[model samples]
Target: MLLQSHLRSVNPDATTIENAAFVAYRKDATNPDHFIPVVPSESIAEAPYILHLLPALPPAWPNGHIEGLRARGGCEVDVTWRNGALASANVRAPHGGSLRLYADGSLSKTIRLGAGETIAWPLP
Candidate 1:
């Protein structure tokens, strides 16, 4: 993925930071994946980061399950599983967050913290 940013224009007062573009691409020919091109009418697209959390057991879960968490900016994700497994991660900007898979698929709870605030989501 390639990202580019530039200053489009500056007013007399120089109070506004106008027009930014984010270009995503895959250079490898083996993995040819293309994103929906953004036109002048619609310049900006908001792509949210998603993490999949799944059980680590054999046979029952192969690719694991999708975790319904949309992360933005800098945040931390804390995961707790039923099999006494605990994991925590801090996410940085410029690159999307990381996806942490717990051994025990049965997650008890997940906590997301950002900017001195925390949101807790319980799983079934």
Candidate 2:
């Protein structure tokens, strides 16, 4: 198999396809994969609605106003991936604040939300 061959070349004694694929996919500098975000459901239960951000964003959306589940002073976002790329995001911010998107320890994007607003922001 291609995975086994790749692994054998990488590590003579290695045998797991999952690990090999993860390393290869993540280290592919030419076309690195998108970072996926994880949101805890319990964090924003009553905010309002969910923002479904797609790879292709819509033309017009309200400024800093998104519909989502109302929560505390923070925001919660969920990510969707397709074919190793980011597909969409569902963001919820009840009290309104800065929603920062990060890749590991690096900051990627920042969005500001109004009170009880939810946004689906597309990431590049």
Candidate 3:
């Protein structure tokens, strides 16, 4: 089967085939037997939306932005996950400071942390 994969070629002018033809050998390898090619799904046309990245850096590499779930102060931090789900954070956020979190690539919550806070989340 001719499976046309949607790989981006650097040279756009490159041609792989001018026509589609299938050659098969019969009983004594004398002639051709014909069949057709089928594409199972339209999903092959392009990559899915998330053939990319998981949004934030883990808590060890704290980015002090709302997009990342890390400490905003001079506090130590740790993040934990279980079975691809966010489990908890060992955060020492200063009073009135907040921790941000993402779920399925969207900003899910922003939590106000008391000093020496340990926070947890339920898995979906």
Candidate 4:
């Protein structure tokens, strides 16, 4: 897809995802270094299926950013940044998802994500 590389923004004019057969992420959620597979989805049965480029082992971490992840439910999630440590970083809701985060063994805050949306939160 033609795209513009920038932060906190997707050039809607240039950015677009199409024909994604299914979403896949690491098995050991939170651990970027894990296996990922794109299986068919029962949720989106009528949706078209198109397998994009197969994913490969992540080479590095995004500031402890779980290197790899799969789109569970329907919405995709991400932790823009964390203060120290991350306790939870996964999205689990079909239409909209909510996830809790913790740092230094302390509950950070609750995160809510909408479908096809990216949320940036601060972790204590």
Question: TM-score: which candidate is best?
Answer: 2
lDDT of 1 by residue, 3-71 (tens): 111212212222222211223333555555644543332322232223233223344333222232333
Candidate 3 C-alpha lDDT tens digits along 1-124: 0011122122222222111111222243343454444443443222111110123445563322222333223333445554444445344555434433333443323345577565443323
Question: How well does candidate 4 match the true structure in TM-score terms?
Answer: 0.28
lDDT of each: 0.29, 0.37, 0.34, 0.34
Residues 9-94 of candidate 2 have per-residue lDDT tens digits of: 12222233232112322334554566444443453332222122332323442123223322233555555544434445556666
Residue pairs in collision within model 3: none
* Shift of residue 105 alpha carbon in model 2, Å: 11
After superposition, the stretches of candidate 4 with alpha carbons farther than 4 Å from their true spots are 1-66, 71-95
Better of 3 and 4 by TM-score: 3
lDDT of 3: 0.34
The alpha-carbon lDDT assigned to residue 109 of candidate 1 equals: 21
Q: Candidate 3: which stretches are off by over 4 Å?
A: 1-70, 82-88, 94-96
Candidate closest to the true structure, highest lDDT: 2
Candidate with more favorable, higher TM-score: 1 or 4: 4
Model 4, span 1-124: residue lDDT tens: 1111111111122222321113454476767678777554464443322111112213343234442344433444343233333324433344665433322323323356565455433332
Sort every candidate by TM-score, greatest first: 2, 3, 4, 1
Cα-based lDDT at residue 108, candidate 4: 26
RMSD of each: 14.2, 16.4, 19.0, 15.0
| Residue pairs in clash, model 2 | 46-70, 47-69, 47-70, 48-68, 48-69, 48-70, 49-68, 49-69, 66-118, 67-118
Count of clashing residue pairs in every prediction: 1, 10, 0, 4
How much does candidate 1 score in TM-score? 0.27
TM per prediction: 0.27, 0.34, 0.31, 0.28
Q: Considering lDDT, where higher is better, how would the candidates rank from best to worst?
A: 2, 4, 3, 1
